[model samples]
Target: RQHNLRIKVARIFNTYGPRMHPNDGRVVSNFVVQALKGEAITLYGEGNQTRSFCYVDDLVEAFLRFMATGDEVTGPINLGNPGEFTIRELAEKVVALTGSKSKIEFRPLPQDDPRQRQPNIAKAREILGWEPTIALDYGLKKTIAYFDGLLRAGDGDLARLAAQ
Candidate 1:
């Protein structure tokens, strides 16, 4: 209130879609790229930890809606899909989508890894009238196609970069 400037703060959760780098290290990209290349899908811990994934298109739409709101609508709002999935479920989905024979490789969970991550978007709905419209399956299929094209274009060059 010091300067009375309008500001919007969005606590964005996991988002994935086309144009994500194959080696971005984010879980979605990691699993998708690995499966596409026939590499083991890495799952840390018992893979029971859950996360909510938001598609990029949905996120962008939320941004636009939030921006169109009046100054009184300043928000520290959460933006993401409320649907949650276990890490193993994500890996299995990636494998199925890519039609890859990759195995699931369990690794030790990082010490600080959170067991669950799901956003409460009630404020987003009340304030900005926003919620994600894309389902995980549809988004993942689009992402997989993008990565597949990249892999083919580079003749597995991107895969090498991921391996490095």
Candidate 2:
């Protein structure tokens, strides 16, 4: 059975940055701390899986805009950056910024992971006039600094296996 109700769904994609689970192991945060600690960065499969990330700030703005719109604007909207990056590239950037001795390691990709995941935000651009301004490098640096602080203050290893 289905209720005859109207609603809008925002299909948000991968988001990253600080405040993320320290031992999340969800790639971005994982790679950041691993690089900071001079550890091996893990990549699944061919490391060609594409992903577009939006900072929390940008995501909040997008949500606000979506809420302000009228019923006519109700949509299956996509809120995320269009800038795509491969797993390998992301790992390299983290290593570069942190100046760590981490190396890249590849493993098997997970089941049901999309090979490509860039949001076609043309609709958002034309409708919401929203696009990500914070470059990945800048965002990653901020995240690295956040983790560095936690590590320096004796917060303990973020990726400790038992911490999960």
Candidate 3:
């Protein structure tokens, strides 16, 4: 109010979908690319760390909805799916969805990586009436298909680089 400007905030969580950088080093992209290339899926810690993934399309929809809200609704709302899953679960799903023979390889958990991460989207639901509708399985399949196409289109080098 000091600046007399209207502002809104949305705390976006992990999101994945088509057109994601194949080597972004994020979990979703990492797992999808590895599975598609038949490489080992690398997991840090025990792979039990939990995260809630929102599809890009769903997140984008929330952005539009949030922006259309009245100025009185200025908020720092959480925009993410509340359906949480373990990192191992996500890696296994990617392997199964892609029909890859990749085995999971565990390493020490990275320093400062949270053991669990989930969004409390109550504000989003009450304010924007928004929640993600895409299931992780469905979204993973779409991501796998996207990476599969990318690898097949001579981007395999990039995928290989990511694995290293």
Every model's TM-score: 0.93, 0.85, 0.92
lDDT for each residue of candidate 1 in 1-164, tens digit (9 for 90 to 100): 89978898889999999888776789999998899889998999999999999999999999999889888877888999999999999999999989999999999999999999999999999988889989999999999998888787766877564353
> Could you tell me the lDDT of residue 19 within candidate 3?
80
lDDT of 1 at 59: 97
Model 2 reaches what TM-score against the true structure? 0.85
Location of the lowest summed lDDT over 10 successive residues in candidate 3: 155-164
Candidate 2 lDDT over residue span 41-145, tens digit each? 989998898888787778888888887787778778898999999988898999999999899988889899789989988877887888778889888988888
Best by lDDT: 1
> 7-79 in candidate 3: lDDT tens per residue?
8899999989988888788999999888877889999999999999999999999999999999998889999
lDDT of each: 0.91, 0.82, 0.89
Off by over 4 Å in 3: 1-3, 159-164
Backbone clash numbers for all candidates listed: 0, 0, 1
lDDT of 2 at 157: 63
* Candidates, ranked, TM-score: 1, 3, 2
Report the Cα lDDT for residue 163, model 2. 38
> Which residue pairs clash in candidate 3?
45-109
Q: Which stretches of candidate 1 lie over 4 Å from their true place?
A: 1-4, 159-164
- What lDDT is reached at residue 117 by model 3? 92
TM-score of 3: 0.92
